[model samples]
Target: MAKDAVLVLGATGRIGRLLQLCPPEGLALRLQARRAQAAAGKPDAGWRLFDPLEDPAALARAATGAAAVLCLAGPVPGRGAGEMADHIRLGEAAVRAGAGAGARVLLASSAAVYGAGSGLLAEDAPLHPASAYGAAKAEMEARAAALGAELGVPVCSLRIGNTAGFDAILGGWRPGFSLDRFADGATPRRSYIGARSLAQVLGALLQRPALPPALNVAQPGTVEMAALLQAAGLPFAARPAPGTAIPEVALDVSRLQALLPVPLAPADAAQLAAEWAGLEPQLRQEQSRR
Candidate 1:
């Protein structure tokens, strides 16, 4: 199979690291990071430093000859107006760079864009982002989509769900973990995807003849925090959930499923745990090898 080259911005992030450990098959990477120092002494690592804000042309040059440009650079967690504005600036840079290369552009958005919602939220669901983070992602999606339309490039926002190892409940687990138990005696439920699955989804999207403006990337259903803990053999104490707590934010991936021949993940607890445990440690092994 012929490999398609992809230029990945924010290559040093957590999700980026996961991608490094489990890249999609038949896809070559041109990695961009914040620091040149990180790429030093690694000839085969495919690492490069290109700041779109400083020199958009450098990004364009780097993205040339790629099938797609995947910009995972995102705002900080708080996602204040200034932070979101900065993120939008980066997103705009991505659009221009991809347009310069005549390649599709994929920007990383978050499920937080749906905010505190119960049941399955589809791509067409209206934005009701609760936090500054959610609002910031919403802004990025709108701006990038609008700009992509103007630029005549295929730009899509990936409304990605929680990855198994990247979620607060899993990654934040300590010796004594405590979770909020809502009045109905349930912990927060969320959609999640595995590291390898996410890579495949992105790869598949890049190869698709047509791309949707926005897509929800996740396993088929929702998983409770407690179920995740149980699957991982981690015990947690339950405290009453505050009024601010959201019960669920499940994504409707029917669209994603229809686009691909393979089935999306089934949202089983054991499999989520296995995927996280299996994929997260490989990063260290990969680093050691590199």
Candidate 2:
């Protein structure tokens, strides 16, 4: 598959942008987006404007002759049946396209699919999605698993947790977190992973010869929320509620490590918080809002 390449299905998202900036070496890329305009200056020779529901064939073509397909595309939040419908439709289309192209597919899922509780969450954890969004992600995970096996496509489902990439579209000015409270010394324990490290994880997975149809991709450790913020130079209201974990939520990476030579090193909270402080403006505002 030397001539073939890796296709990142969500080129417009935060992770997609980082991938564009530093695509894995030796692997060419096919970046699929909603519109050509969205991809205009981003790096990649193969750019396809695809609608998750209507353009399955085009998407299939894009994946055809590729080394692997990284399904990073996800829903734009707005809630309601319409939004839900959009996410499901796109998810179905992506799975179908990748299967048709006979490409190994690595789907980006969420930790929320595990719902809430406390403890280490293993890859085999029973799902108990709490929110509509979480439910949708769980559904996508199920569908991808079944379809991948049926189509004989190697699938690696990465149920990822909080991915921190401070200066990203997903990290843009939004509500809820602040940098000041952090400045004043407010910390809450939470879990987070860096975009660069995440990218490396994806790259390693793409090069794997075989992976389970589903897996969890996460950092091995957790961090205090307040300390996390302080490291980022941001502030927000403090809370004493201890962090909770969803049992059976960890992605067993032993299989992955065996297949690829690269090591997976998680970026710690201090580093992530520092990065977050430098990049996330809305987080600063949100902290101040409190």
Candidate 3:
């Protein structure tokens, strides 16, 4: 049988940008961006330009023959309800338009869905989102899961942790950056996953026969913010952690590991920093081959 063609929404953003590697052994990527302008300055890498909100026909056309759809296009935090509803709207429209029998849809969700939960978070954890972003994701999961049941389509909400390079510390680094050092002389530790590993997780899920309704995506262990900076060989001043600062946010990936061909291993600061720095070089290589 032929491999499934995966339709990737938000194909130009942080996670979708690396699909050029085509991590999955046999599957093909149907990359979709909101518009051509979002993918400017790059080669015509066959990006399907259309907003799921404005052009269901075009988005459906892009999803044609795709057995899996990965929706990564949506607003970040600090947005209004209208913006947060984009993911929900996109999910209903896309599924209505092109949900083939046995098709599976994966929506980009956040670890923020777990809120201020303590200890390792699992998919079954009750949500008490501390921020608007977290609450939005929780609602997205519930609504999408219901939509999936109604449509006879399988929808999985990926509760993803902080992706390396995109996290607050490394992604927002500057010469005079100040890190929150807690009373224990340690920086805030959060669940972290390398970009390549995340891609691999996606590939693994795409290859699966059936997926759980919700899954946590992350490396096995958490890493400290300051350690990531040190591994990147950057300097920063430390400030005493505020009372509001969170010391750690860990995700339980035991569910994820059981389904993968190879279980995810614990991560180190150096390995993660290298993964972020390597993105550009790999992109250049991909460009050269093109």
TM-score winner: 1
lDDT of 2 by residue, 1-290 (tens): 36448888877676776676557766777888887677555344578788766667777778788878887887754477557655555666666777777777788777777777356666676888887777887888787677767777676777776777532222542356532233334433334666666677777777776787666665656655445554655545533433342223334444444555665555477776555445446434433432
Among all windows of ten consecutive residues in candidate 1, which has the lowest summed lDDT? 281-290
As for model 3, its CA RMSD to the true structure in angstroms is: 2.8
Better of 1 and 2 by TM-score: 1
Q: Using TM-score as the measure, name the better of candidate 2 and candidate 3.
A: 3
The reply for model 2, stretches above 4 Å from the true place, is 1-4, 42-44, 166-188, 239-260, 274-290
- Write down the lDDT that model 3 would get: 0.82
What are the clashing pairs of model 1? Answer: none
Superposed by TM-score, candidate 3 places the C-alpha of residue 214 at a distance from the truth, in angstroms, of 0.5
Ranked by TM-score, top first:
1, 3, 2
Better of 1 and 3 by lDDT: 1
Computed on alpha carbons, the lDDT of every model, listed in order, comes to: 0.84, 0.64, 0.82
Error of 1 at 238 (Å): 0.8
lDDT string, candidate 3, 1-290, tens digits: 67678888887676787766645767778788776665566555667888878988887788878888888878878899778877677767655554653468888899998888889888999888888778888888888888788888888888999988777788778779999998889998999998788888889888787889999999999999989999999899999988878889999999998989999889788999998887757655544543
| Model 3 worst lDDT run, 10 consecutive residues | 94-103
Indicate whether candidate 1 or candidate 3 has the larger TM-score: 1
What TM-scores do the predictions have? 0.94, 0.80, 0.91
